[model samples]
Target: MKPPQLTPAALAQIRTLGSVLRVSLEPGGGCGTAYAFALAAQPGDLTHDLGSVTLALSPEVARVLTGARLDYGARLKPPRFRVLAHPNTPHRCACNRSFGVPFPGRVTPECRAYQPMLWNLPECP
Candidate 1:
């Protein structure tokens, strides 16, 4: 499936971070019933080079993520990534998993499992 388009802001942010962002949507479960989304930061070869950044979504989530916009804000205590649904697509994850919610808040095990891997980067902090 074709990856969803990124918002201008998201594209700019990715560029500013000197990283490439990719979306992965793989089929899941029986009849592709289950789905999940994960954000990953690639391993950097050099200390200064920016690594790859990716968002992996289960096949079922591809539709929900389509046209969704990602935003960054420092207003929060620790800052965070926010997902804004497109007007034409307002669907949430059917698995009841929350992707970009604040840390320490309720999150699915699947999402939480990838947090360490996602945020494990020198540039993340």
Candidate 2:
């Protein structure tokens, strides 16, 4: 399969992650050798210190993730990332365990509590 295209925004975020985290596509064990995108975080790394998001796709699903865009937003109710699939492509859970549902475009502020704070950076001292 061809390499997946990364959006400018996604590329910027991925680059900001530095070498602390890696995003790659690997072979899946189930459903006809699917493509899986993993967000592997290194121990004590701040790249994913906040939280990590993974996206695994079956061969059937890769088509859906290709050229897709992921954006982060803030909301008052509940917090979550917004995954926008290309037109005509159905969205699925990153785990491949279930179908994805439409979530709010803005993530709730409450979710920020779960993320590690930049203030905790050891270099702050």
Candidate 3:
């Protein structure tokens, strides 16, 4: 299968910064988490190397990003990489910094198996 592709604009942005794109997950809001990308100089365990900029992502994030096109757009003050033609069709927040989880099932084994101590901890701001 062909690897996921990043647009020329996106490539240029990454190259301008001279760093690999590190793809990972971050808290969106409430209990949801969203895909995140940052600039890094080194590749992580799960990495997809492009000619100029490498993509370092977790296996799960990579799975969700399969066949997606990465592009740069002007939604916010600074243009940012946006995933286009994603299979899951996730919902995005007003600010575009966060997105809804695409998983259909409401719960996961990780949540189901959360330790009691975690539940007793104080809420985070």
Candidate 4:
């Protein structure tokens, strides 16, 4: 599968964060599942070279992230990263933190708190 594409704005933010961008899967209790993104100091076997930056992903993470796109929206208050065309995630909880991959699960209180912050997020096509 093709590696995720990062926008120039996202690249700039990632560059400031660290040399390597790591993508991993977070397994929740029961059938819940989520994706996590972080900055690493170095690259590993799962890393993808993106010219200016390296995006690291485990084999499992890469499979689920196929066709995903990352971008940054500076205009949004507080400024944040956005995901576009996330084919693997069919339903994201109102929180925007956890997603219903293949199926939806119970919503946690923490997720509910983030519901108000979910506006303007681009939906999966």
Candidate with best TM-score: 4
TM-score-based ranking, best first? Answer: 4, 3, 1, 2
TM-score of each: 0.36, 0.30, 0.63, 0.65
Q: 79-107 in candidate 4: lDDT tens per residue?
A: 87667667766556655556644322332
lDDT tens per residue, model 1, 1-125: 33445555665666666455433323332222122223443342111222344444433334445566555544655554445553322223443223332222223444322222222112212
Clash number by candidate, in order: 0, 3, 0, 0
lDDT of 4: 0.63
- In candidate 3, what are the lDDT values of residues 4-122, reduced to their tens digit? 68888878888887758776655553334456777862333377678767877654466556687887775655667777656543554444444454333331223322222111212
Q: For model 2, where is the 10-residue window of minimal lDDT?
A: 116-125
C-alpha lDDT values of all predictions = 0.38, 0.33, 0.57, 0.63
Clashes of 4: 0
For candidate 2, write residues 1-125 as lDDT tens digits: 23234444554454455422233223232221222333454333222232333333333333434565554233513432334444322333344322222112322223211222122212211
* Cα misplacement distance, residue 116 of candidate 4 (Å): 27
